[model samples]
Target: MSDHGGSGEPTPRILVFSTNNISDPGIDLAGSRHLHYPATVSVLAMPCSSGIKPSWILHALQAGQDGVFIASDGEECAYLPDCAERTAHLVTVTQGLMAEQGLEPQRLKMAAVCSVCAEPFAKYMREFAAALSTLGPRPVTAG
Candidate 1:
Protein backbone atom coordinates (compact mmCIF):
# COMPACT_ATOMS: atom_id res chain seq x y z
CA MET A 1 0.00 0.00 0.00
CA SER A 2 1.07 3.56 -0.65
CA ASP A 3 1.16 6.51 1.72
CA HIS A 4 -1.87 8.77 1.85
CA GLY A 5 -0.60 12.09 0.48
CA GLY A 6 2.58 11.59 2.51
CA SER A 7 0.54 11.89 5.70
CA GLY A 8 2.45 8.82 6.86
CA GLU A 9 -0.77 6.80 6.90
CA PRO A 10 -0.88 3.88 4.55
CA THR A 11 -3.71 4.10 2.06
CA PRO A 12 -6.09 1.16 2.18
CA ARG A 13 -6.17 -1.16 -0.81
CA ILE A 14 -9.58 -2.68 -1.51
CA LEU A 15 -10.48 -5.43 -3.92
CA VAL A 16 -14.05 -5.56 -5.23
CA PHE A 17 -15.65 -8.57 -6.87
CA SER A 18 -18.30 -7.14 -9.20
CA THR A 19 -20.83 -9.12 -11.17
CA ASN A 20 -20.42 -8.52 -14.87
CA ASN A 21 -24.07 -8.36 -15.85
CA ILE A 22 -25.29 -6.21 -12.98
CA SER A 23 -22.85 -4.59 -10.64
CA ASP A 24 -20.32 -3.73 -13.29
CA PRO A 25 -22.70 -1.36 -15.01
CA GLY A 26 -23.48 0.30 -11.72
CA ILE A 27 -19.80 0.77 -11.02
CA ASP A 28 -19.28 2.09 -14.51
CA LEU A 29 -22.13 4.52 -14.06
CA ALA A 30 -20.51 5.70 -10.85
CA GLY A 31 -17.32 6.40 -12.73
CA SER A 32 -19.12 8.01 -15.65
CA ARG A 33 -20.87 10.34 -13.25
CA HIS A 34 -17.60 11.34 -11.66
CA LEU A 35 -18.88 10.21 -8.30
CA HIS A 36 -16.27 10.38 -5.57
CA TYR A 37 -14.84 7.15 -4.28
CA PRO A 38 -11.39 6.07 -3.23
CA ALA A 39 -9.01 5.29 -6.07
CA THR A 40 -7.56 2.55 -3.94
CA VAL A 41 -10.42 0.28 -4.93
CA SER A 42 -9.77 -2.20 -7.74
CA VAL A 43 -12.65 -4.13 -9.28
CA LEU A 44 -12.58 -7.59 -10.79
CA ALA A 45 -15.65 -8.44 -12.81
CA MET A 46 -16.97 -11.97 -12.78
CA PRO A 47 -20.00 -13.73 -14.26
CA CYS A 48 -21.81 -14.00 -10.96
CA SER A 49 -21.30 -13.33 -7.28
CA SER A 50 -22.39 -16.74 -6.04
CA GLY A 51 -19.59 -18.38 -7.96
CA ILE A 52 -16.91 -16.64 -5.92
CA LYS A 53 -14.76 -19.02 -3.95
CA PRO A 54 -14.02 -18.53 -0.27
CA SER A 55 -10.35 -19.17 -0.85
CA TRP A 56 -10.19 -16.30 -3.34
CA ILE A 57 -11.24 -13.79 -0.74
CA LEU A 58 -8.66 -15.07 1.73
CA HIS A 59 -6.03 -15.06 -0.95
CA ALA A 60 -6.79 -11.40 -1.68
CA LEU A 61 -6.10 -10.49 1.93
CA GLN A 62 -3.07 -12.71 2.09
CA ALA A 63 -1.81 -11.12 -1.12
CA GLY A 64 -1.92 -7.65 0.53
CA GLN A 65 -5.44 -6.33 -0.03
CA ASP A 66 -6.67 -4.40 3.00
CA GLY A 67 -10.27 -5.38 2.37
CA VAL A 68 -12.66 -7.13 -0.03
CA PHE A 69 -16.12 -6.12 -1.19
CA ILE A 70 -18.64 -8.18 -3.11
CA ALA A 71 -20.97 -6.22 -5.40
CA SER A 72 -23.76 -8.74 -5.78
CA ASP A 73 -26.47 -8.90 -8.42
CA GLY A 74 -29.26 -9.28 -5.92
CA GLU A 75 -32.66 -10.17 -7.46
CA GLU A 76 -31.49 -8.82 -10.81
CA CYS A 77 -29.07 -11.64 -11.41
CA ALA A 78 -29.03 -13.04 -14.91
CA TYR A 79 -27.41 -16.30 -13.96
CA LEU A 80 -29.25 -17.66 -10.93
CA PRO A 81 -32.48 -16.88 -9.18
CA ASP A 82 -30.89 -17.44 -5.78
CA CYS A 83 -27.72 -15.50 -6.49
CA ALA A 84 -28.25 -13.16 -3.57
CA GLU A 85 -28.78 -15.97 -1.08
CA ARG A 86 -25.85 -17.93 -2.40
CA THR A 87 -23.61 -14.88 -2.29
CA ALA A 88 -24.72 -14.18 1.26
CA HIS A 89 -23.80 -17.73 2.20
CA LEU A 90 -20.48 -17.28 0.47
CA VAL A 91 -19.84 -14.17 2.54
CA THR A 92 -20.67 -15.99 5.74
CA VAL A 93 -18.41 -18.86 4.91
CA THR A 94 -15.61 -16.54 3.88
CA GLN A 95 -15.96 -14.54 7.06
CA GLY A 96 -15.55 -17.67 9.13
CA LEU A 97 -12.44 -18.55 7.19
CA MET A 98 -11.12 -15.06 7.70
CA ALA A 99 -11.62 -15.28 11.45
CA GLU A 100 -9.81 -18.58 11.52
CA GLN A 101 -6.90 -16.90 9.77
CA GLY A 102 -6.82 -14.16 12.39
CA LEU A 103 -8.32 -11.62 10.03
CA GLU A 104 -11.01 -9.16 11.06
CA PRO A 105 -14.44 -10.13 9.82
CA GLN A 106 -15.26 -6.50 9.11
CA ARG A 107 -12.63 -6.43 6.41
CA LEU A 108 -15.08 -8.10 4.10
CA LYS A 109 -18.38 -6.62 2.95
CA MET A 110 -21.21 -7.26 0.46
CA ALA A 111 -24.05 -5.25 -1.10
CA ALA A 112 -26.49 -5.51 -3.94
CA VAL A 113 -25.77 -3.21 -6.88
CA CYS A 114 -28.24 -2.90 -9.70
CA SER A 115 -27.59 -1.49 -13.14
CA VAL A 116 -28.66 2.02 -12.16
CA CYS A 117 -27.19 2.03 -8.67
CA ALA A 118 -24.39 4.47 -9.33
CA GLU A 119 -24.89 6.50 -6.17
CA PRO A 120 -25.16 3.42 -4.04
CA PHE A 121 -22.00 1.95 -5.49
CA ALA A 122 -20.09 5.16 -4.84
CA LYS A 123 -21.53 5.37 -1.35
CA TYR A 124 -20.52 1.81 -0.59
CA MET A 125 -16.97 2.48 -1.72
CA ARG A 126 -16.63 5.61 0.38
CA GLU A 127 -18.05 3.88 3.42
CA PHE A 128 -15.88 0.86 2.94
CA ALA A 129 -12.82 3.05 2.56
CA ALA A 130 -13.62 4.85 5.80
CA ALA A 131 -14.12 1.57 7.61
CA LEU A 132 -10.84 0.25 6.27
CA SER A 133 -9.06 3.41 7.41
CA THR A 134 -10.36 2.83 10.89
CA LEU A 135 -9.09 -0.73 10.81
CA GLY A 136 -5.68 0.45 9.66
CA PRO A 137 -3.57 -1.56 7.25
CA ARG A 138 -3.76 -5.31 7.31
CA PRO A 139 -1.13 -6.56 9.76
CA VAL A 140 2.11 -7.59 8.16
CA THR A 141 2.81 -11.15 9.18
CA ALA A 142 6.33 -12.49 9.21
CA GLY A 143 6.85 -15.30 6.78
Candidate 2:
Protein backbone atom coordinates (compact mmCIF):
# COMPACT_ATOMS: atom_id res chain seq x y z
CA MET A 1 0.00 0.00 0.00
CA SER A 2 1.21 3.48 -0.87
CA ASP A 3 0.18 6.74 0.74
CA HIS A 4 0.63 9.50 -1.82
CA GLY A 5 -1.22 12.07 0.36
CA GLY A 6 -2.17 13.98 -2.83
CA SER A 7 1.45 14.71 -3.67
CA GLY A 8 1.41 12.09 -6.44
CA GLU A 9 4.65 10.68 -5.06
CA PRO A 10 5.01 7.74 -2.76
CA THR A 11 6.51 8.67 0.58
CA PRO A 12 8.82 6.31 2.37
CA ARG A 13 7.37 5.01 5.66
CA ILE A 14 9.61 3.85 8.48
CA LEU A 15 8.70 1.84 11.55
CA VAL A 16 11.04 2.60 14.45
CA PHE A 17 11.25 0.28 17.43
CA SER A 18 12.70 2.36 20.21
CA THR A 19 13.69 1.38 23.69
CA ASN A 20 11.46 3.12 26.17
CA ASN A 21 14.01 4.20 28.70
CA ILE A 22 16.91 4.76 26.35
CA SER A 23 15.64 5.88 22.97
CA ASP A 24 12.10 7.12 23.37
CA PRO A 25 13.22 10.13 25.40
CA GLY A 26 15.66 11.11 22.66
CA ILE A 27 13.03 10.72 19.97
CA ASP A 28 10.56 12.75 21.96
CA LEU A 29 13.16 15.40 22.52
CA ALA A 30 13.69 15.66 18.78
CA GLY A 31 10.00 16.24 18.31
CA SER A 32 9.80 18.78 21.10
CA ARG A 33 12.78 20.59 19.62
CA HIS A 34 11.03 20.81 16.25
CA LEU A 35 13.74 18.84 14.55
CA HIS A 36 12.86 17.78 11.03
CA TYR A 37 12.21 14.19 10.14
CA PRO A 38 9.85 12.51 7.72
CA ALA A 39 6.21 12.71 8.79
CA THR A 40 5.74 9.13 7.69
CA VAL A 41 8.03 7.83 10.38
CA SER A 42 6.31 5.98 13.27
CA VAL A 43 7.80 5.05 16.59
CA LEU A 44 6.97 2.10 18.84
CA ALA A 45 8.30 2.02 22.36
CA MET A 46 9.69 -1.21 23.70
CA PRO A 47 11.38 -2.10 26.95
CA CYS A 48 14.52 -3.34 25.29
CA SER A 49 15.78 -3.72 21.74
CA SER A 50 17.10 -7.20 22.35
CA GLY A 51 13.60 -8.29 23.28
CA ILE A 52 12.23 -7.48 19.85
CA LYS A 53 11.16 -10.55 17.93
CA PRO A 54 12.65 -11.26 14.51
CA SER A 55 9.18 -12.06 13.20
CA TRP A 56 8.02 -8.56 14.13
CA ILE A 57 10.60 -7.02 11.82
CA LEU A 58 9.42 -9.16 8.90
CA HIS A 59 5.84 -8.41 9.76
CA ALA A 60 6.45 -4.68 9.71
CA LEU A 61 8.13 -4.83 6.30
CA GLN A 62 5.44 -7.09 4.88
CA ALA A 63 2.71 -4.90 6.29
CA GLY A 64 3.93 -1.95 4.19
CA GLN A 65 6.72 -0.29 6.12
CA ASP A 66 9.52 0.74 3.76
CA GLY A 67 12.09 0.13 6.49
CA VAL A 68 12.50 -0.74 10.16
CA PHE A 69 14.92 0.94 12.55
CA ILE A 70 15.83 -0.32 15.98
CA ALA A 71 16.87 2.34 18.47
CA SER A 72 19.20 0.21 20.50
CA ASP A 73 20.39 0.88 24.03
CA GLY A 74 23.93 -0.14 23.21
CA GLU A 75 26.21 -0.86 26.18
CA GLU A 76 24.12 1.17 28.56
CA CYS A 77 21.03 -0.96 28.74
CA ALA A 78 19.26 -0.64 32.05
CA TYR A 79 17.69 -4.09 31.85
CA LEU A 80 20.49 -6.21 30.49
CA PRO A 81 24.24 -5.90 30.48
CA ASP A 82 24.75 -7.71 27.19
CA CYS A 83 21.84 -6.03 25.48
CA ALA A 84 23.98 -4.78 22.61
CA GLU A 85 25.26 -8.22 21.72
CA ARG A 86 21.82 -9.75 21.95
CA THR A 87 20.30 -7.03 19.85
CA ALA A 88 23.03 -7.43 17.23
CA HIS A 89 22.38 -11.15 17.08
CA LEU A 90 18.69 -10.57 16.57
CA VAL A 91 19.38 -8.00 13.87
CA THR A 92 21.57 -10.49 12.08
CA VAL A 93 18.95 -13.17 12.33
CA THR A 94 16.24 -10.81 11.12
CA GLN A 95 18.36 -9.72 8.17
CA GLY A 96 18.96 -13.31 7.21
CA LEU A 97 15.26 -13.94 7.31
CA MET A 98 14.63 -10.88 5.21
CA ALA A 99 17.15 -12.11 2.66
CA GLU A 100 15.42 -15.47 2.48
CA GLN A 101 12.18 -13.66 1.81
CA GLY A 102 13.76 -11.56 -0.96
CA LEU A 103 13.87 -8.34 1.05
CA GLU A 104 16.84 -5.98 1.00
CA PRO A 105 19.04 -6.25 4.06
CA GLN A 106 19.60 -2.52 4.07
CA ARG A 107 15.94 -2.04 4.91
CA LEU A 108 16.72 -3.04 8.48
CA LYS A 109 19.00 -0.91 10.63
CA MET A 110 19.99 -0.49 14.29
CA ALA A 111 21.76 2.27 16.22
CA ALA A 112 22.25 3.55 19.68
CA VAL A 113 19.97 6.39 20.77
CA CYS A 114 20.69 7.48 24.27
CA SER A 115 18.32 9.54 26.41
CA VAL A 116 20.09 12.76 25.39
CA CYS A 117 20.59 11.93 21.72
CA ALA A 118 17.93 14.13 20.23
CA GLU A 119 20.11 15.41 17.41
CA PRO A 120 21.40 11.97 16.61
CA PHE A 121 17.88 10.57 16.51
CA ALA A 122 16.80 13.27 14.11
CA LYS A 123 19.82 12.65 11.90
CA TYR A 124 19.21 8.95 11.89
CA MET A 125 15.62 9.48 10.82
CA ARG A 126 16.64 11.75 7.97
CA GLU A 127 19.31 9.33 6.80
CA PHE A 128 16.92 6.40 6.95
CA ALA A 129 14.28 8.32 5.04
CA ALA A 130 16.75 9.14 2.28
CA ALA A 131 17.92 5.56 2.07
CA LEU A 132 14.35 4.33 1.85
CA SER A 133 13.57 6.84 -0.88
CA THR A 134 16.48 5.50 -2.90
CA LEU A 135 15.15 1.98 -2.48
CA GLY A 136 11.78 3.08 -3.84
CA PRO A 137 8.45 1.75 -2.64
CA ARG A 138 8.37 -1.78 -1.42
CA PRO A 139 6.63 -4.24 -3.72
CA VAL A 140 3.19 -5.18 -2.42
CA THR A 141 2.30 -8.85 -2.21
CA ALA A 142 -1.05 -10.57 -2.04
CA GLY A 143 -1.70 -12.56 1.08
Candidate 3:
Protein backbone atom coordinates (compact mmCIF):
# COMPACT_ATOMS: atom_id res chain seq x y z
CA MET A 1 0.00 0.00 0.00
CA SER A 2 1.16 3.52 -0.79
CA ASP A 3 1.41 6.13 1.94
CA HIS A 4 -0.70 9.27 1.75
CA GLY A 5 2.10 11.82 1.76
CA GLY A 6 5.31 9.95 2.48
CA SER A 7 4.47 10.56 6.15
CA GLY A 8 3.19 6.96 6.29
CA GLU A 9 -0.43 8.02 6.85
CA PRO A 10 -2.91 6.64 4.32
CA THR A 11 -4.63 9.19 2.10
CA PRO A 12 -7.51 8.89 -0.32
CA ARG A 13 -7.02 9.62 -4.01
CA ILE A 14 -9.65 11.35 -6.16
CA LEU A 15 -9.85 11.56 -9.91
CA VAL A 16 -12.09 14.10 -11.62
CA PHE A 17 -13.20 13.43 -15.19
CA SER A 18 -14.63 16.58 -16.68
CA THR A 19 -16.23 17.08 -20.07
CA ASN A 20 -14.19 19.00 -22.58
CA ASN A 21 -14.48 22.78 -22.32
CA ILE A 22 -16.13 22.30 -18.97
CA SER A 23 -13.46 23.57 -16.67
CA ASP A 24 -13.51 22.91 -12.94
CA PRO A 25 -12.13 26.00 -11.25
CA GLY A 26 -13.22 24.74 -7.88
CA ILE A 27 -10.76 21.88 -7.79
CA ASP A 28 -7.75 23.89 -6.74
CA LEU A 29 -9.74 26.06 -4.41
CA ALA A 30 -11.34 23.04 -2.79
CA GLY A 31 -8.01 21.34 -2.42
CA SER A 32 -6.62 24.34 -0.66
CA ARG A 33 -9.58 24.47 1.68
CA HIS A 34 -9.23 20.81 2.60
CA LEU A 35 -5.57 20.86 3.49
CA HIS A 36 -5.93 18.14 6.09
CA TYR A 37 -6.02 15.21 3.69
CA PRO A 38 -3.43 16.98 1.53
CA ALA A 39 -5.86 16.70 -1.40
CA THR A 40 -4.50 14.00 -3.69
CA VAL A 41 -6.85 14.85 -6.55
CA SER A 42 -6.13 14.66 -10.26
CA VAL A 43 -8.26 16.06 -13.05
CA LEU A 44 -8.68 14.56 -16.52
CA ALA A 45 -10.53 16.45 -19.22
CA MET A 46 -12.53 14.69 -21.92
CA PRO A 47 -13.90 16.07 -25.16
CA CYS A 48 -17.43 15.37 -24.03
CA SER A 49 -19.48 13.23 -21.72
CA SER A 50 -19.74 10.57 -24.37
CA GLY A 51 -16.00 10.38 -24.53
CA ILE A 52 -15.75 8.68 -21.17
CA LYS A 53 -15.66 4.89 -21.36
CA PRO A 54 -16.26 2.30 -18.63
CA SER A 55 -12.77 0.97 -19.06
CA TRP A 56 -11.36 4.37 -18.07
CA ILE A 57 -13.07 4.30 -14.71
CA LEU A 58 -12.04 0.71 -14.10
CA HIS A 59 -8.49 1.51 -15.02
CA ALA A 60 -8.39 4.42 -12.56
CA LEU A 61 -9.40 2.14 -9.70
CA GLN A 62 -6.98 -0.51 -10.79
CA ALA A 63 -4.31 2.18 -10.82
CA GLY A 64 -5.03 2.79 -7.08
CA GLN A 65 -7.36 5.77 -7.05
CA ASP A 66 -9.82 5.70 -4.18
CA GLY A 67 -12.62 7.59 -5.92
CA VAL A 68 -13.73 8.90 -9.31
CA PHE A 69 -15.87 11.96 -10.10
CA ILE A 70 -17.40 12.61 -13.51
CA ALA A 71 -18.96 15.96 -14.45
CA SER A 72 -20.58 17.09 -17.69
CA ASP A 73 -22.79 19.82 -19.07
CA GLY A 74 -25.88 17.65 -19.32
CA GLU A 75 -28.28 20.25 -20.68
CA GLU A 76 -25.69 21.46 -23.12
CA CYS A 77 -24.63 18.11 -24.52
CA ALA A 78 -23.79 18.32 -28.18
CA TYR A 79 -25.82 15.19 -28.81
CA LEU A 80 -28.59 16.63 -26.62
CA PRO A 81 -30.94 13.96 -25.33
CA ASP A 82 -29.09 10.98 -26.68
CA CYS A 83 -25.70 11.89 -25.29
CA ALA A 84 -27.05 12.87 -21.91
CA GLU A 85 -29.06 9.71 -21.66
CA ARG A 86 -26.11 7.56 -22.59
CA THR A 87 -23.85 9.17 -19.99
CA ALA A 88 -26.44 8.72 -17.25
CA HIS A 89 -27.02 5.11 -18.16
CA LEU A 90 -23.32 4.41 -18.27
CA VAL A 91 -22.78 5.91 -14.82
CA THR A 92 -25.55 3.78 -13.33
CA VAL A 93 -24.13 0.66 -14.84
CA THR A 94 -20.61 1.51 -13.80
CA GLN A 95 -21.63 2.09 -10.21
CA GLY A 96 -23.28 -1.31 -10.05
CA LEU A 97 -20.29 -3.04 -11.59
CA MET A 98 -17.85 -1.36 -9.20
CA ALA A 99 -19.84 -2.55 -6.19
CA GLU A 100 -20.06 -6.06 -7.57
CA GLN A 101 -16.29 -6.14 -7.86
CA GLY A 102 -15.89 -5.23 -4.14
CA LEU A 103 -14.98 -1.63 -4.83
CA GLU A 104 -16.86 1.04 -2.92
CA PRO A 105 -20.09 2.08 -4.65
CA GLN A 106 -19.35 5.67 -3.69
CA ARG A 107 -16.06 5.30 -5.51
CA LEU A 108 -17.88 5.92 -8.76
CA LYS A 109 -20.02 9.07 -9.04
CA MET A 110 -21.51 11.28 -11.75
CA ALA A 111 -22.70 14.88 -11.81
CA ALA A 112 -24.36 17.07 -14.41
CA VAL A 113 -23.17 20.64 -14.16
CA CYS A 114 -22.90 23.44 -16.63
CA SER A 115 -20.67 26.49 -16.46
CA VAL A 116 -23.18 28.25 -14.22
CA CYS A 117 -23.34 25.45 -11.68
CA ALA A 118 -19.86 25.96 -10.34
CA GLU A 119 -20.89 26.46 -6.74
CA PRO A 120 -23.04 23.39 -6.58
CA PHE A 121 -20.45 21.35 -8.41
CA ALA A 122 -17.78 22.40 -5.96
CA LYS A 123 -20.05 21.58 -3.08
CA TYR A 124 -20.61 18.15 -4.51
CA MET A 125 -16.89 17.58 -4.84
CA ARG A 126 -16.25 18.62 -1.27
CA GLU A 127 -19.03 16.41 0.01
CA PHE A 128 -17.80 13.52 -2.04
CA ALA A 129 -14.27 13.94 -0.73
CA ALA A 130 -15.52 14.07 2.84
CA ALA A 131 -17.55 10.93 2.32
CA LEU A 132 -14.56 9.17 0.84
CA SER A 133 -12.34 10.13 3.77
CA THR A 134 -14.76 8.43 6.13
CA LEU A 135 -14.58 5.31 4.00
CA GLY A 136 -10.75 5.41 4.15
CA PRO A 137 -8.30 4.45 1.44
CA ARG A 138 -9.07 1.42 -0.70
CA PRO A 139 -6.55 -1.37 -1.04
CA VAL A 140 -4.76 -1.51 -4.36
CA THR A 141 -4.91 -4.92 -6.07
CA ALA A 142 -3.34 -6.59 -9.06
CA GLY A 143 -5.80 -8.20 -11.42
Candidate 1 residue lDDT tens string, 42-93: 9999999999999999999998788999999989998899999999999999
Clashes of 2: 0
Q: Give the TM-score of candidate 3.
A: 0.76
For each candidate, what TM-score against the reference? 0.93, 0.92, 0.76
Each model's number of backbone clashes?
A: 0, 0, 0
The predicted structure with the larger lDDT, 1 or 2, is 1
Candidate 3 residue-wise lDDT, 56-120, digit = tens: 89888888788888887676766555767788888888878777778878888888767556556
Ranking by lDDT: 1, 2, 3
lDDT by residue for model 2 (1-143), tens:
24653466666889999998989999999999999877888999999998999999999998888899999998889999999999999999999999988889999999999998999999998898778888886754424
The per-residue C-alpha lDDT of model 2 at residue 117 equals: 93
Maximum-lDDT candidate? 1
For all candidates in order, the CA lDDT equals 0.90, 0.89, 0.71
